[model samples]
Target: MPVTDYQGSTSSPFSFGRSLLSLRRDTTAIMPSGEEADLEAFQRHVASTLAELLPAADAGAGDEFLSAAWIRRLLEAFVLCQEEFRVVVAQARRRAGAQLPVAAERMVAEFHERAVKALDVCNAARDGVDQVRRWERLADIAASALGAPGEVHEGQLRRARKALTDLSTLLVDDAAAASGAGGVASFLSSHRNRSFGRARASPSRTAVAGAAASASASHFRSLSWSVSRTWSAARQLQAIGAGLAAPRAHEAGLAAPVYSMGCVLHLTAWALVAAVPCPDRGNALQAHHLPAAPPRAAFPWAPPLLALQERLAEEGKRKDRRHSCGLLKEIHSLEKSTQKLAEAIDAAPIPLFGDRENDVREAAAELAAVCESMRDGLEPLERLVREVFHRIVRSRVDGLDSSMHNAD
Candidate 1:
């Protein structure tokens, strides 16, 4: 059905999909009929993209919900929406020429600012992916130690226990930091092992100490490479959502798509912060900071998007997950396998028995599989995040350069 049929809901968002047609029919309008077609197409694409991401309620256990593959698909959808919006914005500008409304300009400008904040989110998420990789390595160590052939040996168990211990420490620290008991510094310090390479023999000890301190300071300040030590995913999301609202009445023509894009941007970024381990990752899912679920009746895409949001939120709230470093499905699988393997190691009698030895090996095999999946998925996921970051940059630059050319 054409989205206009849903116009009986709230006036603003429902008006979003059909606003161009309303403007064309009710009054003289600036958007060309062809541009109106493009806007409608954009909304429909958004709807279909999100609809495809929603798995059925009875989806099999193998379905990839909140998994790395699912997140990749989400990023793909974001890229598609971004590409379509870029076209719509460019077409609107070309048609309007020098007479573009001030409100439309402001809406686009606001979206640009939000897009900048999302870049920081992408950077943090990349680091988070790196963090998960670190965990995967530790799990691989444990898995290898336990999965060795022959009877389960004490020496092998010792190595596996040590790896699990270190993994536990990191996980616990992250949980504590996310809850505000500690902050990102402690969490990052756990991962940073090396110092500045050996200082050359210096004439003065004081100079050497100063240089070392400077290097350490610079390194710590740039904790996640691109984000600062103080950068909180929670605060960054809040910054992106601040002052965001539906487009004002007069601005609904071009402004409506701008508003829709802003909402998608916020939702996508928020979902990344939830799935990946970021500084203050736990608090990033706070409901108030989330884009309020658009009315289901108001937009065709609302139901599926909201379904996914609700599913993620429910996962976050799961009793075992409240303190989880991340809500990604593989992370959950990793944690479960590690815990079970740890328990098996702790409970086993000396020289190991049939079921007990089998348990250890089984658990090891499961953990290894989880690590393998992460190995295959994370690099691609990080690449997608980087793509998102650069795409936003290119769009902003193109928009600014276009405006300058028009002024000239």
Candidate 2:
């Protein structure tokens, strides 16, 4: 089905109803007129939107808009929202018992299970990316130390290097091809106006319906901004990966090192795919009843993680030739940082609307802030990792060249 351009008049390949707002408002009269009604309406809108946005065939086929990371995220979020709504509906039906039809009960259960399965699939794909990233980093370390004077056994290093290189190459080729032909620029242009409401800190629920309506509209817009920023990082990684995969001068025995870098890029691409979520199909009841965000806790984990990272870094700085140690320290720091960020995410609340009366919005804003901070921290780590790998590769190549000239 053609998607309606949020900005331009250009028709999408598949047709969905005019705009999300119009479709949602049109059905408001036919549906019950409260929080539950809004949620049902939102869920229907999301399902219909997904039906339109998602490819009619295989997800891997690479339809221009459907293939985008943001689109995937939007779909995932919609599925989650629907799942949550179904749970509520089931619970309410159980309370009403004899009043609700058996068929209605069965249908609700089925929808909930389907949503769960979809979420699991999305999560598994995300985990695959994370696993590949860890391996890629390991490969970088091994490749960088190829010709360096180290106590590590040559045989073990060579074996590890070969394994990492091969795996990296395979993963990169697959991801690059699977990503399809659509560029980020084209995707952004097509869906520019699909923003959702800005979540804010609020303390009441009396006006939640009005707030939810506005929030439903703005949430995607905010998400689009977040996704676009993340895409920039993904693009950088892809470019680097492409360079690593390219043939270079004196490259005969150095495929492992180059492929190691490529692995990082491929892993990054997969991570981007994992991070995408669908549109926000939230309602007042779900927003009010959902679990509260994590409580503000002491920084127990941060201190220890930071201490270890600092200790490793100090040890590396004290020695002149501990480049490997320095790299290890950097890796440790990144790991610690990642852990801290994850904890923050687990504890942070997600806001559902921008209204001051809605506490959900406040929680959501806090979560967004933490995420922004995490992104800031990751930028430096990414740069450090890239520089370390480049330095190691360059030094190794220089060493190999010098040896050849001496032999001549």
Best by lDDT: 1
Per-candidate TM equals 0.79, 0.25
Q: Residue 360 in candidate 1 has what lDDT?
A: 85
lDDT for each residue of candidate 2 in 1-408, tens digit (9 for 90 to 100): 011112332222322235434443555463445545544444354334434443244544223221223233333333233233433343344445523344443333332232222222233233333333443343333333332333334343333323333322322322233332122212222222211111332335314533443453243223222122223322333333332233234532222222322222233222333222111101100112112221113111223222322332343233321211112222223223322322322233332113321332233233334334334433333332223223223333433453354345
TM-score of 1: 0.79
What shift in Å separates residue 212 of candidate 1 from its native position after superposition? 24
State in Å the error of residue 354, model 2.
56
Off by over 4 Å in 2: 1-40, 43-72, 87-99, 113-127, 142-164, 168-408
The RMSD of every model to the true structure, in order and in angstroms, is: 11.5, 31.4
Report the lDDT tens digits of candidate 1 across residue range 57-126.
7765444788887787788778777767776777678678854566677677778878988888988888
Worst 10 residues of 2 by lDDT: 277-286
